[model samples]
Target: MADDGLDPRRWAALALLCAANFMVILDSQIVLLALPSIERDLGFSGGGAQWVLSAYLLGFGGLMLLGGRTADLVGRRRTFLAGTTLFLVSSLLCGFAWTGGVLVGARVAQGISAALMAPSALSVVTAMFAEGTERNKALAIWSSVGGFGATAALLVGGTLTDALGWPWVFFLNVPVAMVLLALGPVLLSESRGRARAYDPVGALTVTLAVSAAVYGVVRAPETGWTSASTLGALGVAVVAGAVFVRVETRSAAPLVPLQIFRSRRLTGGNLVMLLTAVGAFGTSLAVSQYAQGVLGYSPLEFGLATAVLPVMAVVGSYAAQAMIGRVDVRPVAMTGMAFMAAGCLALGQVSENSGYVTGLLPGLFLFGLGLGSSAVAAAVAALSGATERDSGLASGLNTAAFQLGGALGVAVASTVAVSRAGAVPGFRAAFDTSAGIALAGVAIAGLLLARPRRRRVPEPVGVTMSKEESTCGT
Candidate 1:
């Protein structure tokens, strides 16, 4: 496409990228279904078991900026290949892990690999497809794949854990990733951004800051909020964040150029995405636990009960794509967030005796629709006007927002749940919290996203406007 001579079949390459992305996202959810089983077999107790999930989130979210920057500096193709390979290896290790510590370590490796692969994959798609209708369709399909990954995990996890045991969930990725790797070299094209010196200080400080902050949040429930360990980690995060800001301002080649914030559309989009994630991710954890641990549904039944989400999500994704050319993303995203908040509020009303048919199904349907719609619009907003050079960074920032929001959401929801009365009551409390966060997102979308500009401002000759600056009228 663009005379790159690397991937002549652009759509085929896109399929490969989406598949790899699906593999990574699927791992994140599949583990949720298997968590109870993992606890029983591996002798994990209380919050320690959360490390299996948190360890992955920590590495993935913390290193995302560096991963995205690296994709820009090194070739996207090279980084994708290396990252996918590492993911495959780590998945294999996770399958064979004998202890909680080993599994968590392997999961951390998987997260790091994903940080590299996910952003590069999205950037490559942007490079391959031209902007406008074609790009919108590609992104819609990309987001739908993510929805499928998240929902399909419940079904696949239940089937695997029931039939072949929990280890098979991890083992399943090997073959899928292997097939992707085999096809990657043949179908994918290579691309890179402007050459610049690496900013090691900025990268190191930012990663540490994110890791420390996530750790402090995750541990705050077990250790009191004011505990020395919690406060110390949070303090480290604050200092490191300050250092990272200083490094970026001074460095000739910054890991993340502060100028990116000049784009109001991107900044607002990321904020909405972060807030939406707080609702969606936490709801998933709370609901899954309720279905299995409280309701006493077997793994397979749990899958069947929640299977409606992905199906509705597909409908919403296609609907979003159809509306993209005609409607501004601001309204679309706002409506989506409103639906999410409504769904969470409805689900939060659940009682111990509430059954799947009356209590869960209605809210699940709404949540899925909102999830698909919000994901499509948020992704479009985040990447709306990026130039070729900064596409990878923009993609990385969007993904990092989602990951970090998820980690924080889970921590907050779990903490609230732990402090509440019983399992069901605690879950309801968490759902209420999720709804509140989604409402906050609605406020942001309403205030921050300007109505789309109807008329274009003329520029002087030889002074061309970059797409990033012009698209959102920022």
Candidate 2:
């Protein structure tokens, strides 16, 4: 309602935005299957290797809230274009990177671009599509692209990594970027929110603090908890975080508006998002290692093993498509959460030597099925009440939560694995822990996402508004 001026061009622009989101998500997974090769080629150790993912998460998650707000403050179209440019340039750098450090740095750059672009894309969609059936369909497709993109990344990444080498994973993003950039400027119209002060201090403090903490967690696998590097990083994270909170409270422009946290839907939905992210991250990262290390598969083989996960995701998304108006989003999300928990449990118990035929494949399929449905439900549920003004913030916050959950999952699981001292027992323990976390995620959703149903009816508009506003505000 805030920006009632909807243009017919918006539809084409949203399609392009979804395409861009697909590319960004693809990069998230494309290099994952190739990580082993890259590690061998670059000589990175276990903890050191995680930086490949952690660095990207750090940049993407760290600045995400600020980036989204920047889109609101500036013009969404310009921000989207700028982010695409950055992503393209960074991907080229990543492809060319010779050293582990160079690659990690480039990954950071790519994450920054993702942080900037994704929220704008989501926010643009929110502005373009009117609420109700049309918006639900659009968000469904938007969310599904993310799931499908991850799936495509596996196939594409495997082919590229096998045929052209791991660097090609990054290189692949360049042409896609160019295409999005060209299509975007021609198609997208400039859109802005209420002008607000830019919170440089708050943004920097929060980003650096989170980055430090994530670094500590990611590097913990390599650097012992007692190591100076880990301790110092955590300390920096603490100090920076404290300062960030203080800055946001006093600053005229806050990267995250404290008031938005007041809503139960916003807070609860974010918790669900964060947990789901952890569940999703742990599933993907751990699965690859389990597939190759335990099951004796190659990178391409491992990638193929995951094909079912994405496939299931698409199925789940389609399922949600049919249910949008027929159901409220909470129960749908809860069902998806239940599936994810079940999948995690199945995976945890799966025999180490199990092939896709006997063990891994079934679990992977379950994960895919569960994840696909859950992701769509979460996006819609989270954005249920999003308005044009706050869409960027809400989208950004959800994204930030997801990214942070991913980083946290890897960090925690790796720490557990390392604490087990890299033995078979340790790996098993780590997988068990991952499954437990997923259960915890399921429990959280069961409690928060479902219980709110009692409150949904008396205030349908309020509930819906909560979802919409939460998407924008969070």
Candidate 3:
């Protein structure tokens, strides 16, 4: 470590971390294109095949907070290595599964491993870089890499499934996980929180609550929002959430410290993240359905056509990081949301006979820009105020907000799309809904983040660095 407490190998550590992050995120969606192949090969009946996807989502979304807290308690490097090993084993198991049930089981294990890796890797990144421009740039790269992973999944999944069969999708992770496991111990340092109280009660309740909520949301569209199973799952989530709150209030060492919520930027950043995911994921679903279903494009063609989104997102991430250094996070985030809304509105106008250039490219371009920019801004806002001790918890909260928001987005959009009169009309309605969500994000950013102004003087004597420069780079 340097005099500034920056890790000497921070950049290399970041690359390893981002690679792990990308692999886990890639697995999340890579299986989407392979679902049909999986179903046919494993003799899945009816909608049972969807479980291969849902099982992973439930485990990942549900266990993320626990996983992050675990990193803080057990040591980030250790947790990361353990997670990678499990992920490797799970991926191998998924590739070799002879039955649909076995594949789904392996997928759940993969999700668990992802839950461990994501926050731990992120917290490590936050720990390695000091909270300023360096961290901001690192996060920009991190956000852009995640965007690429999601987009790559669509393209890679199709190609791999077509060429090498669907199992290759799972097999792809084996090599990546092996490399991470090999390099992790060498590149990363061990770090854990001072507090040692496990708070098992709080942990259990929060996990149950989040898991149940994710389960309810993901299943709502298929099971019907009013269905007993859906209502029951949501009810369990509510009750568990209530219990978790109560437990945290009285626990000697809380799973999530309630005091952390006092940070206005942290709270607001999380809300922005949630709403951003709502717009990003929901609108992507709408666009993908429109391109492939109505436009008569094959899976590969659809992926290639929509590739512009991730490319522009990469541009936007770097641009937003640069902009944030000059101004408050508010303007950049609000502008990003505005762009997203505009993109959604444009896509909403798509017709049955619309072409890619005239209909899809423009909207995707704007949405991608917004997606990348807003993501960086939100992450910066959420993580900047965190003390080193609470870094993992903060990272977990941010990641959980995103995962939950994505689940909500996909559910709401699917519900709206299916309830409409026709395919085109349904997709249009979904896009419009996504635009509304983006607009809501704009309002949240404006209200929560500081207004733009010229650079102010440095902090007064005795003030800490973290408290003085709280609003991302502002």
TM-score of each: 0.93, 0.88, 0.95
> What lDDT score goes with residue 25 in model 2?
76
lDDT of 2 by residue, 158-253 (tens): 789889998898887888888898898788778887788888898888888877887786777677777999999999999998998888889876
Each prediction's RMSD over C-alphas, in Å, is 2.7, 4.0, 3.1
lDDT of 1 by residue, 1-474 (tens): 447443468889888999987887787667877787898889998757768877888878888888888888898889899999999999999999999999999999999999999999888998788777878888888988887786778789889998999999999989988987899888887888888889999999999999898888778877877899999999999999999999999998888887776667778888987886777678887888888888888889888898888887777777788887898778888888888888888889888788888999988899888878888888887787666777788889988887778777877887888888789889989988888888888888877665545445553222112443554443
User: Each model's number of backbone clashes?
Assistant: 0, 10, 0
Residue 391, model 3: Cα distance from true site in angstroms: 0.6
In model 1, pairs of residues that clash are: none
- After superposing candidate 1 on the true structure, give the runs of residues whose Cα lies further than 4 Å from its correct spot: 2-8, 45-47, 451-465, 468-474
Model 3: weakest 10-residue lDDT segment is: 462-471
**lDDT value, candidate 2, whole model:** 0.76
Candidate 1 backbone overlaps, count: 0
What's the C-alpha lDDT at position 462 in model 1? 21
**Lowest summed lDDT window (length 10), candidate 1:** 459-468
Winning model by lDDT: 3
Model 2: how far is 205 from its true place, Å? 2.0
RMSD of 2: 4.0
Ranking by lDDT: 3, 1, 2
